[model samples]
Target: MSEEPGPVPAAAEPTGDGLVQVAYLHPHQVSHSWHESVMRLVMYDQLHDARIVGTAGPLMISCGSGSLVESRNLAVSRWLDETPYEWLWFVDTDMGFDPDTVDRLVHAADPATRPVVGALCFAARETHHDGMGGRRITAVPTLYRPAHDPQGNVGFTTLFDYPENTLLQVAGTGAACLLIHRSAAEKIRAEHGDVWFDRVRYGDGRWVSEDLSFCWRLGALGLPVFVHTGVKTTHHKQVWLSEADYPRPGGGEAAHGR
Candidate 1:
């Protein structure tokens, strides 16, 4: 990946008559550090003419014993039903972005082209198998592009060498920081009911992540998901780290520092 920032396309100024209502939804826990990161973005980021709603403190209803998925689902459902917001921006507490992150994401989600846009963020996963007798760990970019096998089965993997500063169609992505249109949310609710985010079992009998499950539901309605690579975000795991600290896909360690 290039060390320099990618070129950002100019976004049109929002007219008074074209204001968009947006709810900044944060699914948080008891981490003060992450909470502060969320506050900084909410306080400083430019979100076009969006009227931001929601807060960084206890935004989700408690589901007892750290039910992250259920909490997020309840919060999103309430926002869709009670608020007139045209968009829902889900920013996990552990995620940080530039001041123009929201603006860039909104620009990418042009109603005429893209309805759902996710920012590029880092994520880590661990898998265990009795045959291996140990856990295998993998860390990579969560933004993904879809692919198919010769047998016609769909699959997803990180775009390790994707072109810079472009909008790429994705099968799904981690909702750590994503911009979603109300129209898509409404469609899912009307067809699948209020259970918006959760682990869903696919035909292969494997449980999909909550983020992918939501994307799959939207895909069923012909809505496409995209990742705006121009708008990069930092996943604040363990301690604060920038994009440079992220482990590359193939093999390499990023410089680690404060």
Candidate 2:
């Protein structure tokens, strides 16, 4: 697609009570050969599914991680601030979410609970005692910890004691998948810069991790990210093994660019 910045008005409308804002992180991060078709059939089509329920509609934004987090993350943030919705779902290109996903996610959240602003965990964390604090929680075995884990060493939870369903202040949140409420995003942008995904390799703390720094900033502000264990969406990355590469019914092979 186009490389320009700013929010692209979604062709769809809201199907649910929540304002769904789907943002793609590092569309360029994946291998180009599978980029176009994957996005259209999977990412785009999935969002389109919500049209039946009025939970559809999102500002599609693509940005390179590092510096100018404000300009990047805030592009959508600004658009969202101008909108009337309360909850905003920030998704990467890898995410596969639909109306059912939205409906279920909202149900998973506690109505009596105050607003939470943290990374939504589709992948469940292993629980020992169970607790919630600082508005964050870490997976028992996070997808990344294994890669960095010592050979044969069972990695432990970075922070312990969290509620089964509650807002957790995690050390960092991944842009790969996160559901941010409008008030939460506004609070975050005011404190830190913008949402950084670390798409760029050659950068410092601010350059490399948007999700990471985002949680830190949100936690610092005491905004807990409400963890919805029930809601989850498939994440599609730019890779040969990605499920998004699967062909559509009655279709040929997936093309490179859309």
Candidate 3:
């Protein structure tokens, strides 16, 4: 016998213009900080003009042993197929950003120009000095430049020289907090199949992260990927600190490490 589907919840019912669909990489358990961030998102969605249709939960493959990267990719692709949203705003559960982060990112993402825009989030790593004695800042898997190996194959080099308080073109970046247009998502899925995110091995024999791999795909399609340096998000760790609150190398504000 065929089973009947359950009634739709009022919260899940369509509201507003259905222009954006927000999703996050949530695990079974989350921290207090993450809870606070989720609350902020909820409040922002209510007050914002761009109608966010829904916020989907995490995709669990097993009992807390699934690849979060692949899970997020699949979840987002499904949203693209099932929802009528024009944009997908992906935020990591542990990330902390301003309530206006989504507004700013969406404004910057002009469909005619920028199709993929990501916020700058610092990685949890030790700070070190570069060869020129300057402080080497580490971002979330941002590419420095393109490289060629002995076999004449090309690869990307990760870099830390990111601009502050401005938008800049990037070869690839992390997806801790990113806003992707529907056009770009559909294009990638049509050409690359459903596996939009995957680890790619470059000529240098190093594996590119999933986020970077997605960015590379966008770049290949002639879509410009940009980082809104002004929209910095906090990556939750043992000690919670955002890029805005973090101190710089010489006792100055860590505004995008500038």
Candidate 4:
């Protein structure tokens, strides 16, 4: 089989060894209006305090989703092609990450022994109050919305002792606060062309979803993942899920399993 393309010549300023590059995926200009504002908050409050060492370069950001999931993924992939770092993260611009989150991932554990984690996503619970019937307080998670367990299951912030670092049947992850190791990022890029997710525009004339596609592909590869609750961030929106969004499986649908 052909190997994946080599990484672009990595920059040396940000220190690429444990260099964690975050891609603040924000595809506004269609749905929400506070997108760019959230991006600025992240840079000023969180990523700005971040630092890495011993490998390539500094952090990166991309805010070109353009209200379409496909276009947004394109922006992220473009960053991956040009970003020079050992690790990559994808967070929604609205999510506020821990200032020292990069430092945490860099020294999580010795690289030789641990399953090079595909991602380490932060955790947060969003309270969605529907303006109509009573109050529909939804639990909007920051990352790794592992619904495959006892139904309505969110994730953890601290890294658990999981085999291969993955939750079983995890549907997808929230783009709020996702951190990916470079090794796994390379593997993902090899399969899916790059950090930019494949585009799929539905009848609404907008690219619908790609983060789930990206996570599904990674999970299939048996890459480890973690729920880093320490790094709390917000999704910054009050959008609730419709049955159309998260439909049940066939055969009347069983609850998510462990």
Candidate 5:
């Protein structure tokens, strides 16, 4: 079976509608829920007055049994070299999102400033003891900020404190539902090679994910990463979860992400 096939571009001509062109890239396997989401997204695009450009094209699927990093890098490379799209949207196969996700993410992107914008994704942490000493699995945000390890090695820590329904600047975020401007990828390629996604080991022996590694590289190039908290997404683990599943810092239901 052949892997890493480039996506076939759509034949539509530019409508001069001013919508930013985007390449929808999926580097992982898909689920039935994700397919329904994509169909709804297509309908949303067709019905919306201002549609996302270049979405008429088929999804750029970079399938491989290698590393996730390899698949992601291949997809981004194809988006850069094969297509004229201005943005690359990385959507994981297990994610559940609203129909308007593309519209919100594209509009949130500022190619010169906020070149990378991620939707809110939550992941389950290992079972930890609650205040009452009962062990429980907690949901945590994938967003992060710069921090130092015990040995003073630079790394990232989960950003627990953030405002809801706002664009919060982040050091790194999971690639499940991420938007990357073409210019940002170009800048990174200019400095480093075309390897946009990589897993790096910190001096403290902590391993960083490919997505976070990409974010760090972007940060090095003066590109900022932001997460629009209003754009929520469900991550499928044993069960599908969202930001609403997150346990507040002090354990309250009054506010989200507090």
Candidate 6:
């Protein structure tokens, strides 16, 4: 990867009529909780649009089908090739979020600078410390910061001590609730030729996820990735996980599980 920042394209201004279009992109399948959360978000978006665009309606939704990577790539292609929306918001079917999640992320983003913004989400399953460090279920955040492994290979590690209720720049984050600008997408497409989301095999023989891959590309292009900690989200696995469940070392609270 180039240490020098790739040239950032100018961000697109809102339409002459003061309209800012946003497309809601999702993968196949939907849970009841997620559906309800999205409905609330859409309702909020409708009101926002009415004030901004002089009309009110649901956001343009595009759902992709297939495997995770495939679905994401398909959604990206559709958003770039088929839609006229200025923003693409990726929301997972298992995610629970506030109605203002979209507004928070959009307000935090500056496409010319911070083009990719994501809301904080916890890992669905709790993890235990390696070795005989004791068996305590620790809740982990999806945010990541760049670091080198013991083997001297560059990679991203989970950000455990991030500040809450603030917008913080990060190396990457989960795609559960991410917002992308059209300019960022165009720059990425010009550089990588449509290979937006794909798993990468690192020098250490470890595979990084598609979301991290996309984030790395954005960083290479001089676009910063930000996480709005105030916009907390839930990741549903066998159980629901939220910010309250995040690990707080020495905070006296019990671990997530026994």
Q: Enumerate clash totals for all models, in the order shown.
A: 0, 28, 0, 10, 0, 0
What's the TM-score of each model vs. the native?
0.71, 0.49, 0.73, 0.51, 0.77, 0.75
What is the C-alpha lDDT profile of model 6 across 21-49, one tens digit per residue? 44345544667788899778767877775
Best-fitting candidate, scored by TM-score: 5
Off by over 4 Å in 6: 1-28, 50-66, 126-137, 239-258
**lDDT per prediction?**
0.65, 0.43, 0.66, 0.45, 0.74, 0.71
Model with the higher TM-score, candidate 2 or 4:
4
RMSD of each: 7.0, 14.5, 11.6, 12.9, 10.0, 6.8
Q: What is the alpha-carbon lDDT for the whole of candidate 2?
A: 0.43
Better lDDT candidate (3, 5) = 5
How many clashes show up in model 5? 0
User: What tens-digit string does per-residue lDDT give for candidate 2 at 100-208?
Assistant: 5444444443322324323343444323332323223223312121112344432212333334433333434455445555666677566654553223321222233
Model 4 residue pairs with clashes: 11-56, 14-57, 16-55, 16-56, 17-55, 65-72, 77-196, 157-228, 157-229, 165-225
**Which ranking of candidates, highest lDDT first?**
5, 6, 3, 1, 4, 2
What would you estimate as the lDDT of candidate 1?
Answer: 0.65
What is the Cα-based lDDT of residue 82 in candidate 5?
A: 72
The better candidate by TM-score, 4 or 5, is 5
TM-score of 1: 0.71
Candidate 6 Cα deviation (angstroms), residue 50: 4.7
Please give the distance, in angstroms, between residue 214's alpha carbon in candidate 4 and its true position after superposition.
1.3
Which model, 4 or 6, shows the larger lDDT? 6
Report the candidate with higher TM-score, 2 versus 6.
6
